[model samples]
Target: MANPAGEAARPTILRTPLGRVRGSGSAKSGTHHWWMQRVTSIALLPLTIWFIVALATSAGMTHAEAVAWIGHPFNAVLLLALIGLTFHHAAAGLQVVLEDYAKPEWVKITSVLAVKAVCTLLALAAALAVIRLAV
Candidate 1:
């Protein structure tokens, strides 16, 4: 059926473990997540590409040469940034996925927290390695 203004729409109900909630397209969440994902994705694009190219260029090099390549100040800084942002992005994505799909409260929370901890640790390790190499 159409409204007086001639707009027809079907309402959506959100069924969650908490309870039933109504959904609104204009609500703050969707747009916020979308923007965040896009921004991080834009960051990852150049970073991953650069890392890939760096690896490709070093493919046939000796270990010493590869170490020397990574020891450059600019390269070390970029590597650290890439590692940190990559983990942050992964944690954010997995958090959203778990929040949306996981039905059990404990499971969802544990999974999200576990992912966050592991990724954070990995990112820190990566950054430290880069810094050590640079120094």
Candidate 2:
């Protein structure tokens, strides 16, 4: 359709994640979030494989033996990395889900905050456990 001047109508641009209908676009932080999720996933791959293999090899390790294994610098460091990346990735992914589906704006914001807080606390606890074991 043409306006009063007989010019063609403007093409409709794609809506953003929040469904904005104007020139408004990403808040500029999405790229960082996207990059972090990608980076964490890539880093988690090797860490997860190492963890699984290490666990498989030590299948029957007793409590003390497991503790001793964690006491090793190599094992402790890898375990810490695994915990950190896993939780970081988890929070990022959950935030995306919340942003996409949560109906109420306040609810979405609150849920995201809670998810991040819980993930952060869990990650810290896991790291602390690893450090305690290593000590």
Residue 135: error of model 1 in Å? 1.2
Q: State the lDDT of candidate 2 residue by residue for 28-126, as single tens digits.
A: 885899999999999999999999999998899998898899889999999999999999999999999999999799999999999999999999999
Judge candidate 1 at residue 12 and give its lDDT.
75
Q: Compute the lDDT of residue 31 as modeled in candidate 1.
A: 78
Q: Least lDDT summed over 10 consecutive residues: which range in candidate 1?
A: 17-26
* Best-performing candidate as measured by TM-score: 2
Whole-model lDDT values for every prediction = 0.83, 0.93
Clashes of each: 0, 0
**True lDDT of residue 43, candidate 1:** 94
lDDT of 1 by residue, 75-134 (tens): 888888799778878989999999999879999999999999999998988888778778
Query: Global lDDT for candidate 2?
Result: 0.93
Question: Model 1 — TM-score against the truth?
Answer: 0.72
Error of 1 at 122 (Å): 0.2
RMSD after CA superposition, every candidate = 6.2, 5.3
